[model samples]
Target: MEKEIDFEKHLKNAIQEERKLQVSFFDLVSKFEKKISNFDFENNSILISDYFYSGNGQKNIMKSLISENKVNKENCREYSTKEGNLKYDFKGVYFFLLDNKPFYVGISKGVIGRICQHLKGKNHNTSSLAYKLGLLRYEYLNNKKHLGKRKELNFVTEVEPVKQFLQKQKIAWISIDNDEELYLFEIYCSMKFKTILNSFETH
Candidate 1:
């Protein structure tokens, strides 16, 4: 009789704990939504097609031909404003939008640098979304069960199609410095926007 009573008490306590956690989670989500409501994402966003087009034609040609090592080296240069003087580096979450609908959300310590990777990156580690899109659209990649193994993938041909697709998309980001808040807000935004490409899975 005592053991039965103890189990009932434990179950009640567990239920209470779960309820508290759910309440806390909803409260935190509300706070995050309020904070994000003020951000001017549309005005702040950069169009991938426009940004790259602003550069010289020769530079674009060179960028296309350059090795990934050279591309990474080029990315190491500080991000700048249109005036080409002020440098801005930030840690935050970024969005990939197609036809004004968000498809993916990602967080990085260097948001612009990360965006560059998605735009021009040559491999799976750098351009994961493009790789995933390739897997979905290409029959060759679709047949390969080991496509997740980076070594088995052929990035050279697969990446260009998705890269062009990404160029048509728009990017927006907001700075969030606190690591805890950054991660939580990413989850919140991903859920709120119903981003199709985002997978909050552990590797």
Candidate 2:
């Protein structure tokens, strides 16, 4: 009986401490909310439509952005891959907007590289949103739901329209070097903006 009472006391103290921490965390979140509210995403935004296509055909979106001086070369870091050396922008949260409203919100250490993956990558790991969009298209066209693995989706044909759709959208980002705040701000932006493509589900 005495031990039970002691446990209850400890639990009460812990809950009180947790509540205090929540208050402190929420105060910080309030500051972030104000910062996000004041952020000018319009003039600062980079439009993908201008860089989506070249004289030949659809071009590499990242390379076009870099070539036209839309993305800051000084902030990009290059690394070698089997294909060739590629550059990625510094850490930040990025937003994909359609009609000037946020549709997706994402975070990455390499913001530009991650966006490239979404626009150009062929597989689910590299182009998840495109894959989902393609899957939806497949279902809509076939009038049947896909029950197999996402990898089985026909990227060459199905994802082409999805990539085209993404190319017509606009992108904007804010640099957040701190990982904790970066993650929290992503969720906050997704909620505040009511982004449709963001999923908080754990894999």
* Model 2 residue-pair collision total: 0
Best by lDDT: 2
Residue pairs of candidate 2 with colliding backbone atoms: none
Candidate 2 local lDDT, 1-203, one digit each (tens): 99999999999998888333333556658778787888887866877766544342223555666687666666666555557755555678898888777888999877876777788676787998788788889999999987888777888888768888888888888877667778889999999998777899997
The C-alpha TM-scores of every prediction are 0.64, 0.72
Residue 157 shift from truth in candidate 2, angstroms: 2.1
Error of 1 at 71 (Å): 22
Assess the local accuracy of residue 10 in candidate 2 as a C-alpha lDDT between 0 and 100: 96
Error of 2 at 181 (Å): 0.7
What lDDT is reached at residue 99 by model 1? 69
